[model samples]
Target: MLVTEKSPIVIVGCADDNYSMPLATTMSSVIANVSSQRQVVICIIADKITQANKNKILKSLKKPNVIIEWLIPDYAKLTNAIISRHITIASYYRILIPELLPEKYQKAIYLDSDVIVKANIEKLWDTEIADNYVLAVRDMDIDATYVSSSKGLQNYQQLGIAPDCKYFNGGVLVINVEKWRRDNLSQEIINYISNNQQYIRWHDQDAMNAVIAGKWSELDPRWNSQAVIHSYSSWKETSLTEEMYNNVINDSYIVHFSSSAKPWKLGCKHPNRMLFFQYIDLTAWAGWRITFIRKLWLKVKDMMKKKGISFSQA
Candidate 1:
């Protein structure tokens, strides 16, 4: 069965003046595609959002199934603070809004801005978490257990996490909002980061991993197939083809772009990255014949102005 309010899928991202318009466009397109026949809510967390940005986002979103909201203390202050440059504050903005999310929505699927959702997100929303605290997928590259013992992770032992619990990635999370609030998980995550600011590498993800290390349920890797070397190397070496994607349509829920080679960036070899275009014409995101032409014009102008190259070019 297709996912609906009974199984709402929520996507979260942070944006500001500094954020890439393409990334937000991509996210909005993905949200619009997945929520076509169901109730889907896409929340963009930012210190403040501008009217211009709102119009751009709405224009890019081609599907009426998606609902976009700017999670802020007050919409009036959105013009004051820039979000992308302030990662920590952006994080706080996301953390602050769970209380405001519908009481009916006890759980949500949170994805980072860098991902490309290739399939119906409803499948992921429909996943049975059973009695797990929260559901998450482990990082394909960095073994949290190993990385935790490496340099800068000396605090791992102090946090009381079992050594074998495996440090998981927080980029894609199935959050149990009520449980998180009831257990004070968000506060614990914030406080833990505040207390140990120096030892962490990733900002909110690391702190969240520590807070819910052993507590979370291990989700299927396909739900969050990281795009790092380890995961990519494995995929490239396998004999898997488009047949795999076709056959596992229902079983495979999300295609997580959790590595350096994002679809928006150069040299993204992951097969699923191409799937993003199917939901929305990636090149036509800005309402042009081809996205690349618009991109080329922007790049040349930027280059003439001495602006650095973008990841899409590099």
Candidate 2:
């Protein structure tokens, strides 16, 4: 393929051994949707990812115009980063992308492993970043008001952040690598996470929001339709209007499975769960299936639905 002279779309993703499949699935979705004219460079910040899984990821993304770069992060610096049952220390590796990637690349798009791209990413790459630190979608689940939810910034008052400031989801970030490097934002966010460990609920995401509040531009919600948008009650809780909600639900460019009930899991009811599986089937983990228990449960649910009996997991 003859690539264009335009700057290659640089994408950065982080993963460990457990997340290798999801990362590969994310890369596969990007490669599948991206235009052939543009060159895409995918940088995987690896943390103890096995050779076999790396091979699987490579096999999943077999595009002529797409180049892959494997980066080893400085784990020593990330040792103290907090992690939950589902998230790993690797989630903190995105903070290092500005310093780790080659200087020639001034900007990059960072996507979490638990997402699927449904449109040509070149459009997102072309967003006018100007002087902003990052372009991200407003987190639909977290309330901007400090008193509304504990999930919101716990120390917003202490951090001097406004009570009504918008909080962005770190899952999809259009980062201005040049600005991040110049301002030393990476270390600053790290320090915030360290100092506010007791108050930090969402780890790097909370730190980024605190350190870069009001600095990031908001992208269209369709670019990152989070799991919360699937339900009417949850979507209504967000600031999204009815028209905006309809647009995002009907035509999401990227479907982010940001909730704990992931598509790969047995009882996930996200509207895009099947869409996620479609991309997974295209990957090296083709024909991957949920356990027999899950399959049986699905059958039972289908039978109940046929009898007009609604089923909901408690």
Candidate 3:
């Protein structure tokens, strides 16, 4: 398909050394799926990525119409933000994109490193933001209310937000850079994270939902089919109807591995996990797969750590 847009479509992502492979895989999928007629500029907020990995990433996305620009992030500003075993300070870097990029870029699509693009991203870029700060899909697994999972905003009542406000997954965001800058949304989100650290479960995602609760536009769930949609029972738990669930699972534009069980890791049962590897074959990390021995070793180490037996002691 020929894209008629005059300006380049700006796509933003964040990653550190640990997430370099997934980041490259995500961008490769974008390049593979995007229109050849449109110019694509990918701005990655890199945090301590090794030069070797940078070269691999560049090589993976080496296309005539695609340009890769790396921006070094200031980690010191994220010192007080909460992080978990799988989550890192890099997850919060999406909040910095508006100020980090040049003023000429008024809009951008922010994708998580764990996602694999299946459709032309120009379609997503064409989505109208209008007066909204962002356009995102509703979170399939969680909501605004604090429930048994402890994943949603715990202080919604305290924050004067309604109990039933829609909560969006931050995995795929079509951001309005101008709206964010005018409202100083990034700083407000950072301040919310700092002040309400105890209430943060999903960290930056939670902060963003809290700060921009009613201002964001909702996209179709097919745009961001989260990991939860893979399970029939899990899909029933969310707001999606049976048809909607099936549609998203069967034909997702972007498959997001939102759970801890990632496609690269052992025991990831998501049906689309192999699809991620399919995109991987199109990148610099082609033919890469985690070996069985390595998986077993990792499993054993996890079991040993749980049993309080350190590797040194063993």
How close is every model to the real structure, measured as TM-score?
Answer: 0.72, 0.89, 0.91
Candidate 1 structure quality by residue, lDDT tens digits, 15-124? 65434354464575566547467766777766445566566666665456767766655443222222232243554444444565666667777776656666677767
Error of 3 at 312 (Å): 20
Model 2 per-residue lDDT tens digits across residues 110-154: 999999999999999888888899999988764542322557788
Q: What is candidate 2's TM-score against the reference?
A: 0.89
* Residue runs of model 1 more than 4 Å from their true location after superposition: 1-7, 20-23, 26-35, 73-94, 145-153, 229-252, 265-273, 276-284, 287-314
Q: What C-alpha lDDT, on a 0 to 100 scale, does residue 135 get in candidate 3?
A: 96
Model 3: lDDT of residue 242: 77
For candidate 2, what is the total of clashing residue pairs? Answer: 0
In angstroms, the error of model 2 at 195 is 1.2
Model 3 alpha-carbon drift over 4 Å, by segment: 1-4, 142-150, 234-236, 296-314
Worst 10 residues of 3 by lDDT: 142-151
Local accuracy of candidate 3 as per-residue lDDT tens digits, 102-212: 878898999999999999998899987888999999888744322223566788788887766788899999998988998898889989988998888788988999999
